[model samples]
Target: MKNVFTTLLLFSCLISAPSITAADERVKIIPDVVYGHKFGMALTFDVFQPEKPNGAGVLFMVSGGWYSRWTDPQNMLSWFKPLLDEGFTVFCVRHGSSPKFKIPEVVEDVRRSVRFIRLHAKDYGVDPSRLGVWGGSAGGHLSLVLGTTSDKGKPEAKDKVLQESDRVAAVAAYYPPTDLREFVDEKSPYYQRFPALQFDKELADDFSPLLQVTPDDPPTLLIHGDQDKLVPISHSENIMQQFKEKKVPVELLVIENAAHGFRGDDQTRASQAVVKWFQKHLAKQAD
Candidate 1:
């Protein structure tokens, strides 16, 4: 039986997919480690590697709504074992969800995660420069932030991870809210949406991912359903316009009659598009 979540972004992976297979030998699932434990509380991540890796790249996924700790065993990482099959290292990170931590702090946690991965890429069996990230909703926002604002991080910290820019070579975003202010101000066309109930009106604009992209930002793939009410297709439309203005390579997909998940006719096609995007950029990166 196959059950799918009706969120703006959907991933079809199996919890049992990796356990009973020999192909996943080189893969690793890191349980817990504190990234910025001092000031912003302890942030953590789960890193998954590929066997006999064909390339040096990472596909990082940050969770939605800015939460702390990825609790619950089965419900923890349920359907995300496919990246291993795709031959790219994958990382699922946990940062402050919301209210408990503001958008700024949550985005910082994502930046730290990128630095941490790049700093330890060699030990993790990958190259630091060949990194990419993907996410949905708030995670999508951070993906763009980390991918675009990477140059803002200092490149000379004693910690090699901190020294490395938080940049990613590519990104795949699913029905993400690019601008928080616009999201709060209007209701998306679709009835079902996912926004942290505690959104702050004053700071929303400062944290909008669409508002921060620069000309040098990494190439991006923005996927959303035309019928999505939670995250309007307008957001994707707006981003595509900005991406064009910045001259950054961007691919935006709007599935017809699709809601957040884009499940019925959209899921398979959109997923394939993401694979192609990654193959083009992440797999062909300079070593």
Candidate 2:
């Protein structure tokens, strides 16, 4: 039973797909776009361009359990249809997986992907400054990391992508683990299952979103289920408070009676909320 629960918490985030419909046909997909390379592996993401674009981009962190898995971009069309219909081009980003790489390394790969995307935003017809990111579970954790830990580019860097800004305009995360300090000591109930958390104890607070929030952090939306035992609603609540104290724009949507993942009507509501959050925050960036 413990193993089954762990598996569900790890992979359930990927199962919140809405049914495929004609709306999928309105988007053009560009797949396997490499953003960076490390240790002989390519970091890549897929771009889904709406027929009518709103000039903004939203990167969907393609992660669950810190394991970035590849899926048919076609199968994801329905999942992205909400964002596409709103004229936002979507980037499904995959990062280095865990049980091989640790959490810090996974975070670095995602930050590089953001910089790479910002560097080529014009090529994708997206406004580089008008970007947002989102995900659930481990992906959500990454989104919050991006929101709080984003940095201005190193102008002295020789690599052009490294010289590009990694900041995003907004973030929306679902049931993210905000504070990873509990896992630093391997004390969390999930420590054994999520190998990504098996890292140096000193590094936990450095990557924790709750501890990293600052006044300059981007607008953030956090959605969680009240009954989420895997991540717990407190993760969102605590970070929401930090965002508030820092005077950063933030909102929390608590799904009643839901668990680790949303299903049926809950998924629909969660999907719609994410679309609205991105639209509200990403669409209004000044030129």
Best by TM-score: 2
Which 10-residue window in model 1 sums to the lowest lDDT? 1-10
Top lDDT: which candidate number? 2
lDDT of 2 at 188: 65
Task: Give one clash count per candidate, in the order shown.
Answer: 6, 0
Tens digits of per-residue lDDT, candidate 1, 1-287, equal 01212342333121223234454444666666556664545677766666655455655554544434454323333244455567776676777765466667677778888888777787777777778888776667777777666764575667666776787888888877787775455353221133353455677666777788789888999998888866688888998889999999998987888876655347677767777787788775453
The estimated TM-scores of all candidates read 0.80, 0.95
Across 160-212, the per-residue lDDT of candidate 2 in tens digits comes to 99998899999999889899998667766667777888999798898999999
Runs in model 1 lying further than 4 Å from the true structure: 1-26, 38-41, 68-78, 155-160, 183-202, 285-287
In candidate 2, stretches whose alpha carbon ends up further than 4 angstroms from where it belongs are: 1-19, 285-287
TM-score of 2: 0.95
What lDDT would candidate 1 get against the real structure?
0.66
Error of 2 at 162 (Å): 0.5
